[model samples]
Target: MRIYLPTTLALLAEQHAAGAVLVPDGAVVAEDDSEDAEYAALMTAADASAVQLAGAGRRVVVVADLAAEPAVGAAVPWREVVAVHADVEDRPAGADPDEDLAWFATQEVPDLF
Candidate 1:
């Protein structure tokens, strides 16, 4: 399953370097069929990161692919992040409701911090 993580640019870099993104707490934020579902989840994560803006200026949506075995539920506890979609290159600065996320591709994220 493909999951979208709302995080900072620096944290993304750290995850990239570490080869894993760790989810210490909170619910698993991911994309659903509804475009609204995907957007809402992403926005919720971005909103949560507003307090920690010093490390990275813009909110980043990390697209990761996890194995289909583990289902997301109250009983499931996810920790390490493994595979990431290698298509999305960059995340734009600031929030824009007009910006379309469907076009995001796999590539190196630009220095937005």
Candidate 2:
């Protein structure tokens, strides 16, 4: 199953360099549909990363296809879901419920590493 893994840019770079996505804890997945729920899970992951690493650098949501299932400890969405690495810039300025998932410049991504 695919999962949305929220992480900092630095960590992402490290993982990229290492050539793997270890499927860390707190990664989220859609308990229902594949399209919308994945989007919602992605947003949730992005929002969570933002909160955890505010001002550290650009946040990243690593969409990965995991072989095994991790513990699911959150509420239900059952919303449609998909796989995509959403940046802070993907979110519009002053958007709805998840404003924290707003976008940031990709240029700064290098510096974060």
Candidate 3:
């Protein structure tokens, strides 16, 4: 299953350093098994990310492919992360609600800091 996990920049940095991120209870997943279903999940995750924001940083959604359906609360290894969707820049507090997140490959995750 493919899941979208929304997280704050500080928590992400800690997880990146630890080599895995804990899947939140609020993580977003498609209603069905289909590529098309993932987009809505991603957008939902993005919106959830916005609520998690504090201070200043980009909203991040980590995209991971799992071997089997995950049980909501587990750790996703850093290696499992295939891509990331994040705000292009550190927006001011209360930035535009409709601004789009930029797509980035897993390899570029470090440079995002």
Best by TM-score: 3
Tens-place lDDT per residue, model 1, 33-63, is 5768866765555554443453325445554
Q: How accurate is candidate 2 locally (lDDT)?
A: 0.56
Error of 3 at 4 (Å): 0.2
Give per-residue CA lDDT, model 2, range 54-99, as digits (tens).
Answer: 5544557766555566554432122212233545443333335354
Q: Give candidate 3's TM-score.
A: 0.85
lDDT score, candidate 2, position 95: 39
Q: Model 1: residues >4 Å from true position, as ranges?
A: 24-31, 54-56, 67-104, 110-113
- Candidate 2 has a TM-score of 0.61
- Using all chains and alpha carbons, the TM-scores for the candidates as numbered come to 0.52, 0.61, 0.85
Clashes in predicted model 2: 16
lDDT, candidate 2, at 107: 37
Per candidate, the number of residue pairs that clash is 7, 16, 0
